[model samples]
Target: MINFINKFKGKSSMILRKSKPYRYLICILVFMTTYALLAMGLLPEKYSLEVAQVSPATIYAPRTVVDPYLTKLAEDEAVAAVPEVYNLEASITVAALSGLNQTYASLEEAAIEEDPQEQELLLQAIKENLSEEIEISHVRKFINLTSEQREYIYTNTYEILERNLSQGIKIESIDRAKNQVINELTLLTTDRDIRDLLIDINVPLVRANLLYSAEATERDRRQALNEVTEVKILKDTKIIDQGEVVTELHIRQLEALGLQETSSQDFGYYLGLALLIGIVFIIIGVYLNIYNQSILVDSHKLLLLGIIFCLTLLLSKAFSYFSAYLIPITLAPLLITILFDRNIALLLTIPLAIFSGIIVGNEFTYIILALTSGTVAVFSVRKVNQRSDLTRAGVIIAAANGLTLIALSLLTGSFQGATDFIKNISLDIIMGMVAALLSSILTIGILPFLESAFGVTTSIRLLELANPNNGALKRLLIETPGTYHHSIIVGNLAEAAAEEVGADPILARVGAYYHDIGKVSEPYYFIENQLGNENIHDSMKPLESSKIITNHAKEGVSIASKFGLPPVIIDLIQQHHGTTKIAYFYHKAKEQGEGEINESDFRYPGPKPQTKEAAIIMLADSVEAAVRSLKQPTKDKINDIISTIIEDKIQDGQLDQCDLTLADIKKIKEKFAKVLLGIFHQRIQYPQK
Candidate 1:
């Protein structure tokens, strides 16, 4: 048993060593728990219902489902309403014309024959070739007619066939069409024999041109069936009234909604829901892996993210029991934006809103409301300077929520009466406002704890530390006023440089404000705080002066720690000087004939600047002190000094640790030059002097 426990512990330790597997385990746990929570609320409730019995209680649909029987009935009605279609062949008319012309041409050929035997033979052939309705006697009479009379009969016959057959004839209209052709010929020709011959020739030629098309008819029926809208039973709609007798319709509806005792558990629904949530998780995971891999690889950040996701899901589920509109949908996004970045917050809001929608029975209006309000909350707190700013952000989120609810209400028009409509709108507004306010209130209460628990510093805390009233800054201001003033100039320079290089300006500025807190311990020992040019360092050995100067960085870390400054700010305080040699003391020691002076003894211990903000503060701190030391700090002199300081730092390899590119360095140079010029620019002498 001891060996088994040790083996399990060993395996657990191995799994935790690899961040990806650990992260995956956390994700799996979150996904399973999230699925369980959603299923608890969303799974259908089974009822023991029967026909002609009073319902024990009213039941609402857990999800939208189509009434298959009602939809089938509607589709059948739609198909029955569709008219049967027929197609005109058009070839039937052409065939009729061809047959009539052949008969007329044969008769004409026989009429042109002068030999009585040949003419009789031709008439016999034409009669045999004709339809059974056309007799040889009619053909012989047609052959016996004068050529002009024959031409007139042929023209009348052709006209009759063309007119009757061109109009589409259905199977029922064929006889009427034949009689009409016969009547037209009778009115056109007075001779009985000619009319009878033309009747026989044209009547048989008029076939039914319009034919029933089964394919077209079936296509129309299928279209009508497709057009039949399904009868959908909405979620949360009362399926049966309490104390009402259960009927066959109620039983069927219950079965359709999987609410009947006989209805088996819908594994497919559970599978579909799981797959949908899996897709949302995949989207968030893929985004983090692609654009923000550091978060995915960091155990603490990943744990925080998973916790936030699950917490939001649980809160949304719990709140949905009251009203979906009252869910604090902005909470996750607001926390994420403050803890991480805006891009992650925006992308993550999509899945969070989708989860909110699911918790509320998939209300799409709630999804829209959540996304709109969450996005507004993100932008509002993008740069939190104070705790009250969060309250202000809450007010903005409330306004966004109220506006979004009003727009959705207007679009859905779910109101039934004027008084109810007003009441519903007012309730929505109040709930939406409460939800927004609740998110803000929760964020404020939870922020400090999360910061302490996670060991992360937010912008709001940085801003607070930057306040002159803070213990560290206040001590530096009172004990080392000159250093305090110098630190302010460094902050201005650092902020401008940081902004130009796309680094966090607030962090750079705040870090600068506390970078020299150790100087407060020995205010008069520093040159800037000395009275006139009284040199305290002149009386001390060059090595001792260097030691005193280098000790401030270490002392600043201790001071900042005592003051409870963040690790990142402490890092800035420690790394501002990097490992660069203190040139003044080393040069002084060498010129004073101090034998074989070692340069390493005069250097400050450092881990270098590990981030762009740290690097900027270093440069800003150096440039501010160097430019202030120049007696004639003109524009040209300040520009030259700033460039020289940057170049020296670059050559000394102080910037090697940070990710500052050459382009960023150039922008920093320009910004430093511009700011220093503004500070050291000339002022006109007074006329009274």
Candidate 2:
């Protein structure tokens, strides 16, 4: 029963390891738990109110007036009548004055001439010249006079003229004074017209004042117009009597009518909203995992990176509560890139952005901010190599964030408020910079665990390992100096060849440095590690010698695993030897008539080179070793050796498994020939002894 239980547990573990659904469930659980805790109060419930006001439409009208041409004709006619009215008054005055003058003149003529008939006629004309009675109705309105007023003016005018005559004025003086007399008569008669004119002028002035007051009152009333409506509710309440003051309870009851109670369902709705947001974030995380190639290495690395990314998101939220200036959420992707690969960093950036949004409360502003920062972080540090590189990248991220914030502020017209604008802008820069720094810090902290568990050899780690003083490399140098020197040359050759074919030159170089590391186990058995000593292989049988040499490939893989080399480098170490036979030992055995010898025993273990770098390293290794065996090296000999090695590998089907095509092989052969020629170029012949 115990064994069965153990088997069941193993199967479950295997299933869990292979199951995508299980991982997805774990991711969802993590997201939900984090959202529930970190975003509890982060999300704010949004409420909207729409308001509209009712207003009266205004209308405008123009005042009407009589036709201009008709009014002009009426004014002209009235002006023409004024002259006639004045002429009539003048004619009457002239006639009355002429008669008075004639009476006086005739009396003087009768005393002087002794002509009785002339004298009598003159006297009769004077006596008969009575003042003509004029009809005044046509000029009455203009003159503003009543009939009694006109008569009184006429009497005064006559008396003034009689007074002038009584003062003994001469007849010539009377004729010249006729105009003065007429003017006096006209003034007396028109006094009532002037008084009535004053009344007419005063009436319009009074009416104008009243109209102005009415217009002003109408303007004020229009300004004061307002719509007021009252709503009443049915309720039972105590009321005060009409003569008594209202009690506080009455006022409280009125106030209670204005209060509203919110429904409990609102909170439930908000909770569901939060859940939906959390689910969206989880879905984003899963999609990012599937499609993002950078982070999609083996399952182990993905898991480690996912955990770190999620943790960073949660920690950023927790720290944000204390102060929003703490750990930047975008640093998660940057950190992944720093410790792992850029592809992974870019892939994880999406989920990390989603997590950042959730932590900051799922607002559109926060989501956009997080996404912008994360994208900037990933792009800015794509080529980061050192700790200080992250600092530079951090500054870049800060600048990008600042620019984005300033642009947004400008677009939203919120830049007028200096304090809030500067504060928000500063926060964006600080968060971006802090994210970069924190990413570097967290990357350094988590790198060892990830490297150990996933066997990732970052460039920084490789540089550290390349130092001659490193324990493993130093041991190889001191104990097997010849092998060490050979490995360095092979590394140089492999790096050049790998670069020519557009393969990973760093991996090729590093693999070359460690490719023959197992030769250190039996240092003297290999030719390069034998120093000046005798050949160990000469004393051993062909098959035994072949076995010893073939064993190094297996031993190198074991050592690589023990030392935690990545699977890619380990594959290179193993497949660098491929299934090629140990030709020297195997051919010697054939010539010696060795019967029934297993060919497989003489070959390196089976998996051929699967990548260009591994295949290049294998070819470089063979060409370098074969060129060293030539007695007198020449360009022709070096070229022949390189071509033979390539052709032999091709004919033996060792290159079949690798992706190198016939065209690629030809290119590789040319590159090898050129490099070999340069290495074996002729030097100046020394002077003979």
Candidate 3:
């Protein structure tokens, strides 16, 4: 069981370490967690409810907020207030007039005809057309009427019907039009049959003419509702009273306030959050690929960067739970600046600030604050010479945070009066300062662990290693004191050159200090550690002496790794000599007329300087040794020797693998001359003291 568990653990570790997908999964998981947390209180909730439920308690706006629920409700109310629409048809009046005129013509034709039965039949047909219940006796009296009586009834009935039904007729008001027509016809004639004919024919025919338009009514209501804008509930506004019955409005308010816990309609909200997270990650990925591809491809760098970003975000989010001002926005940027370069730190800071602004709910203000503080943090320790520089950077960042808070306070009108301004601003200032100071303190505390765990070589770590008490350097000093002294001068020259070329001088100095640790293994075998006239190499063969010399680069790397030094320093130890041949021993072997010696055996095993620091150290090692060989060296001799060594290295392709350019080499040469001139400056022969 124990073996099985160990095997399973080993397999899991291998899968996690070797698979890009697993690392990506971890990265996306962290991103999604942050996105979910940010979206929790920021979006509105969807509630499951109906009308008239008892509200559990009073609710107020948690922050400055927009109530989309209230907005929709206002739109609905506006729609309800709109009056119903109807359609008027003028054809109804025209049809009624035509029917009355036809009746009158039938009555006139019946009065002139000798056939009274036909006339009565026509008038009866007209009466039936008006209404099936019209009396037959009334039809007979209408047929017997004179033309004048018929014309009067026709004109009067047609006129009344036109006046009433032509413009519009509501379905509910149909009877009023019928009544008006009846009253108008009654006054027009005293004859009972004439009155009955007009009333019976026209009154029944006076039906509701206007059509109810449901589609048109809805359209009009919608148009009116559209005029109303969305309603927003302000921060701290009271939404309900305790024990108040929950109306639909109350439910809407609760949803708008994001207080309803169970919302089924949050897919869009979560999707938007996902999109935001994806965009931020893509931007960070593209930038790293373009400017720092090594970090993007290497799992250690990628995971370490993600860890720092997430830690900073989580801490900021935690602080925001208490107050947004307590967000230590500078921490990630400062930490990156110390561990990595300022460019990577600066590049990542922008996205960090954007995420902070989104998380805190006031993007403009929070963005400004984060950017100002993060930028200060970047510049503060960009080229940290010692640990104290980190402290100084923290103070500067804190001061910048205070100033930014002051500006924001004044701009936002966050004060009722001068005293209020002072009190509030002071509190905010303290929060900002404490956040920056805490970030600085935390960064310093965690920096060593990060450097060790990630295999990163920061200047602070280099400085720590450069201390005299370091085990390897101490061993070199005690076992090979001459080599240690030689290393110190080489370090000084390399540091000056690195500084002139805008490279890391601290890295150069630290690398130079430990570059000769291999000499400690066999101290007396090398010239620098020899004390008496007899040299150990004089008794040895050229091949043996050359082998000892060649083996030191490999031995130095071994010693550096044993000391737990960074890979960068080990790289310096391994590559400082590059593949340069030990010329004296090689020539001596050739002059001895030994069978053709293989050139490869005399050369140092090397991956020639892989960085500017290592390359600079390589040059310094050779220049310091070459200058030391000159008896009573003058300033001119030191200058010429330094220039020749640099040129020779360039021609030998020693700097080809590193990033050093022609311009950087020129600056390095000038810096060497300046430093070497000081070391070999002409002394004045003053009067004997």
TM-score per candidate: 0.75, 0.61, 0.75
Which pairs of residues collide in model 1?
none
Task: State the C-alpha lDDT per candidate.
Answer: 0.86, 0.62, 0.81
Q: CA shift at 5, candidate 2, in angstroms?
A: 21
lDDT of 3 by residue, 49-138 (tens): 445766566667655656777777788889889888888876776787777677667667766777768766766666566655557777
- Among all windows of 10 consecutive residues in model 1, the one with the lowest summed lDDT is 10-19
Candidate 2 lDDT score at position 645: 88
Please write out the lDDT profile of model 2 over residues 98-180, one tens digit for every residue: 65445334434443444657655644453343222222222224223444554454356447665443343333344445444
For model 3 the local lDDT of residue 616 reads 93
Off by over 4 Å in 1: 1-18, 48-57, 62-64, 80-212, 234-238, 241-252, 261-265, 414-421, 467-489, 496-502, 517-563, 588-601, 627-643, 659-689
- Prediction 2 global C-alpha lDDT: 0.62
